[model samples]
Target: MAKLIRSIVVSAPSGTGKSTICRRLLAACPDIKFSVSLTSRTPRPNEINGKDYHFISHEDFQRRIDEGEFVEWVENYGQFYGTSVKVINDALNHGKDLLLDIEPRGAKAIKKQFPDAVFVFVLPPSPDELLKRLKKRGHESEEAIKIRFSQSNSELKEVLWYDYTIFNEDLETAVFQMISIYHAEKCKTNRLCGKIDRVFKI
Candidate 1:
């Protein structure tokens, strides 16, 4: 099948299985490219600077913000995260399918520009379950987890407007749902109209 250039924006609160789901989805559909975000925060021990995120100095991040090089940016936990305008533009311009793993703020910004893009919200089994998962992650302090758990309610509210929501109760099932979503999006009539024309309409 001819793959149509598409954009997938997946957003979820911290500690949710959004990252894991995205990883599995990418592994299953290796052709789709992931849009690495830019962050002013220090990289975690296992994360690679260019792959996980474009880690940069606060001063440089501020300069880029001043230059309007980002499509959107949001500050969380005393650090900044952003999506590059050039990165996304080049992908769509070159007919590449792109997956963006970002927070709701960045996802909303992308939606304004790419109205046709599919926006998915990943959810934990429940709010209480999410809090437990966050605590278990051990990536943040107790105070930070409290703040994030509180903000999670607001993030969850964004799901009201999202195209789909995947309840990540089971890892394997969730990955399958994510992959199914991507394939279904690829087959959407609007997305495949041109590609179909070349294959059969002629």
Candidate 2:
């Protein structure tokens, strides 16, 4: 009668609002759990150790890589980041849906390991609009923004591989679309025996 947990990976280019949507989704849907990633980058001024990211030295990250603890690892903008296979397996084993907000490359890696995992790619309504939003943030220099834009192109190229591509023009609308997907995934026959039994219940 209970819903089985599914692992869903959400990937997007920078400024696609994946983080905000993920946070809102968790707040709106209590049963969903996020995959907290480990990074070799330093924690930002406002970031906490575990909540924002598990910051570690390059040496430790390499050690983890050698240990084969991560499901997938990537080096982006001179920093390393990865999602742990153990973390995902533990959450799913406990009947909690696991949501991973990762890069396209990482998403591809996770997909290879977990064939049934759902992949969602979030995109801005238009590339121009995306550029505008990135500029408005004013957090990075022009060079940095350009580099991110380049990566966005790379991320967009892999959109066809995803199961769903949501245009995040409006935050609320996008979140609702994702919610609909999450609910639909829960109703899968493999996840819901109750639904199968309901027809004969009468």
Candidate 3:
């Protein structure tokens, strides 16, 4: 039998450096594949279709929802975003671990469908540091920054439901931590059941 593929779901508030950490993790782990999400929102200037996100119309998004195509989905900032069940299962069936970058709400939804998935929550070193990072980004207005900062507080509460939490204070340290978790999980007894059975047979 082929080895079982694991899914890693990562969640973090805006400006928490989750994207940077995830990018590093993917570069370091060749066996892992990033799961691109479908979004009703328009692509940003540097965003590529089917790369950053699969941009679609509101009607199409709703149609997919009706068709039960998504494993999990949520509406944020007046736009819809979701992960397709087929996309996830297909990668896992091919023996590829999947890395999912989602918000707290969508993460919760995914947990319901895939209880065995590894849930990781990323956080800034401190609230003050989080504020600094948001401001340093220079992409949002003052009011928007304030709003995001406030939302981060509630998002932090969801960390309690996660399997692991990583403080993204230093990019290198954070990436190392994630890689460690990946390696540890791959060696877990439950994840190695197939190999264990074969060993016994031998």
Candidate 4:
């Protein structure tokens, strides 16, 4: 039997350094691949089309939904975002772990289909610290910052449902924690049963 490929789903409020941590984790683990999400929203200033997100038209996104091509999808702030089933299945079939950067709602959707996936929630040390980081970015107006700050509280509530929660106070520490989780999950009895059975000749 082929080895089981586990997936990691990470969700965090904006400015929690989730992306930075994910990048570092990917660099440290070559066998893991980041799952690129498809979004109907336009790309941000520093964002790349295929690298950051697969930008698609609202019409196209809706069509994909009707075709059942997405494993999980959600509409947030009047924009659609989804994870492609094909992309995730392909990685798993190749025996590669997949790292998904998704929001709470989408994560819930994915959980229904992939209950064994490791769900992690990243958080800031404090609400004030999160606000400070958002303001430092200077990418949005005061009003926009306020909106994100308010929304963050609701997002934080979802952490209780996640399997693991990591505070992004220190980038290196947070990345190390994530990598540790990945390695630990791979060693679970269910994941290693095939190897164990072969070794015991049972």
Residue pairs in collision within model 4: none
How many angstroms is residue 17 displaced in model 3 relative to the true structure, after the best TM-score fit? 0.7
For 1-202, candidate 3 gives per-residue lDDT tens digits of: 4344468999999999998899899999989999999999998677899988999999999999999999999987688999999889888887898999999999999888788999999999999999999999887799988988998998999999899999998989999999999888887887777887888863
Total clashing residue pairs per candidate?
A: 0, 0, 0, 0
Compose the digit string of candidate 2's lDDT tens values, residues 68-95: 9999999999999999888888888877
Of models 3 and 4, which has the larger lDDT?
4
33 Cα displacement, candidate 4 (Å): 1.1
Worst 10 residues of 1 by lDDT: 1-10
Clash pairs, candidate 2, are none
Tell me, what's the RMSD of every candidate?
Answer: 1.5, 2.0, 1.7, 1.5
Q: Rate the local accuracy (lDDT) of all candidates.
A: 0.89, 0.88, 0.90, 0.91
Please provide, for model 1 over 26-58, each residue's C-alpha lDDT reduced to its tens digit, 9 standing for 90 to 100: 888976889999999998879998898999999
| lDDT preference between candidates 2 and 3, better one | 3
lDDT, residue 93, model 2: 85
Which scores higher on lDDT, 1 or 3? 3
Worst 10 residues of 2 by lDDT: 193-202
